[model samples]
Target: MIRFVFAALLSVAAATAQAEVDIQEVTSPGGINAWLVEDHEIPFLALEIRIEGGASLDLAGKRGAANLMTGLLEEGSGEMDARAFQTAREGLAASFGFDNYDDSFSVSARVLTENRDEALALLRAALIDPTFDDDAVERVRAQVLSIIASDEKNPNRIAGAAFDAAAFGDHPYGSSLNGTAESVAALTRDDLITAHRNVLTRDRVYVGAVGDITAQELGVVLDDLLGDLPQSDAPLPEDVPFGLAGGVTVVPFETPQSVAYFGHQGLKRDDEDFFAAYILNTILGGGSFESRLMTEVREKRGLTYGVYTYLVPKDHAEMVIGSVASGNDRIGEAIAVIRDEWARIASDGVTADELSAAKTYLTGAYPLRFDGNAPIADILVGMQMTGLPPDYVINRNDYVNAVTLDEINRVAGELLRPDDLHFVVVGQPAGVENTN
Candidate 1:
């Protein structure tokens, strides 16, 4: 009887060890869909907010409008001016900020559980009652304009802007997330307000929080904060597939080293071959010191300190991007090496050993990503943004394990075409051959 009890306890512990993380789907009394995870690991809490369909919905000729709107949100709201808002948050010992990137704008907050009530209250005020003060707008506009001027002088920035323009054309995603000199100057307070009203609605919003909080507490707190915003059932934009830009585009800079980007289109976020592509990319360039790109480009020739390739799949467009920096003289040769590796992978795919190492890396790194509430909150926000099922994280390892040599080769052939690459190079390399 004692032996049977021991065996039963062992089985229960094993089953618990492999159980999926319990992620709660919280609906705020105000009808907000948030992903919540309760963990008492620390005394602090992490809350992440994603306003879907970010800059892609910027209207024609209003290139910097969405970006500017997101910036002004926390600058001032309610009775608080920009300085007052800053002072209040600082005095309260709370952290709050918002920023916009290519795909989405996010606001993140980290505060002690003791301060949760006041912290979330202030956050809500900023989101719902932003004033878009005229003087503040002008000040921010000047700052943005100065930044744009600075970017024009940056070789890497020039190359990136040029590449996006060539690749995305008229797509909103192609436009600089930071407005151009002309567009930033043209934006007014009304433009910022309109853009904010259109995009930051409750229906498409996702809020995720983890650490010293319960699901019920979070639901109540977030409801008080975001419950009154207008609900939107806006339709997502249609997929815009990326195609190769026919020729090599070069932006000449007089610097000692050249920065280059090569590769064409890539897979979408929800592609069935997601794991397969993930594994293949690691073998190609995503791995740290072990990747093939680093071995050939850096280790073999001593050309670049680092080289990498990655995929970015947004609502409007998806792309495969590769970047390398090398001395101006060897930039051309470096580009050639990149193409050779590219072509080789396109034709032959990764070897069994390469494939095995990549799978191991992917699986091994999964747990490391969940070590903190902030990272866990980030993962939850990302899953909701991409429309992934809750169980996707639990099944992630199985997906990686399922990728076979045949599937890797098939995906490599279909997604990669070396000759069809759009290469962008910045700076001058003295000893390198020019293939453009």
Candidate 2:
């Protein structure tokens, strides 16, 4: 019953947020900046923080330090042990999450306005004084190692790992942020501390706050929550151009089906033609059933259940990648069809009907993203990371709508590289030829 009420309220809030978002930029007394959206309809708030140079900040030979440190954040803090910390957070009905990605570390909080003070204090403790105690360290380390073990056996992971290794070389993006089993096992508590110091510094932080809070209140909240964090510029990974070329690298595994990951270089997020490329991809293989790859590979040939491509514009490098899974015997056909579509789109570009349909879908679907405070807060922080203006929430779909047919086709001509497409397949018993 309580859940139903909460869900209904969330639905209404989402509708309101979809209609309009008035984002205000706030600077705390301590000079920390944050983006805010106020909604006093409910006594709820969501705070999102992004610390740049996430796992990429892990020092030489300390590959998993940032990830390990992130995992240990909620495990314990200040004077409390892991269990005590969790109990206290639960008592205040607060939620805290910590995650590490290639370019940034994310911290999220959701709390009632009544408990905001208590919730934020606990969150601050987690950030400023995480206790990487022996017990917590071993526990989280074992969990990470277990994950590594599972990923090794997973065919999809195998294909992606091979794909990344081929594309990114020795850049941190080349390897799993989880690091190798050896690297993770060798990480000391001090390594985690160093990671915390390096990755969570104030110099590279981006913040977003949404729900029952004003700019003034959020200003105070920001200083209180993040002011004490060390102010140092963390070193970001150097940019490396996409290095993979067109070829097939087959890894032999005894399985009836093969999982393939493929792609080559991609454009940056700030590329002038990114919007055009986005729409073009939507018509090509943007995960929907309407995509050319899905229509050809699944409907016509019955080669795979799904095939899709995406633009991966990372902090340092960019990529246009796609994935598919099919019977080992038919994986060859899937790859051939995918490559043909790549060339077809690159050669002829999308039709006018396809462009119109893609624009409508893209524009129509944009508003549904603001489902609630947390999601909007997430979008706010993401915008900051990507250098988007606060008003982008209003004008984003306009950019997609503004892409002319000529513009997208021109991008297609320049962007899609059928000759340089790469495929990494994990499985045996196939008709596919190994090119590498």
Candidate 1 per-residue C-alpha lDDT over 101-135 given as tens digits, one digit per residue, 9 for 90 to 100: 76677888876666678777788888888999899
TM-score of candidate 2 on Cα atoms, chains taken together: 0.97
Q: Residue 51 in candidate 2 has what lDDT?
A: 89
Off by over 4 Å in 1: 1-20, 233-238, 429-436
Instruction: Summing lDDT over every window of 10 consecutive residues in candidate 2, give the lowest-scoring window.
Output: 1-10
lDDT score of model 2?
Answer: 0.90
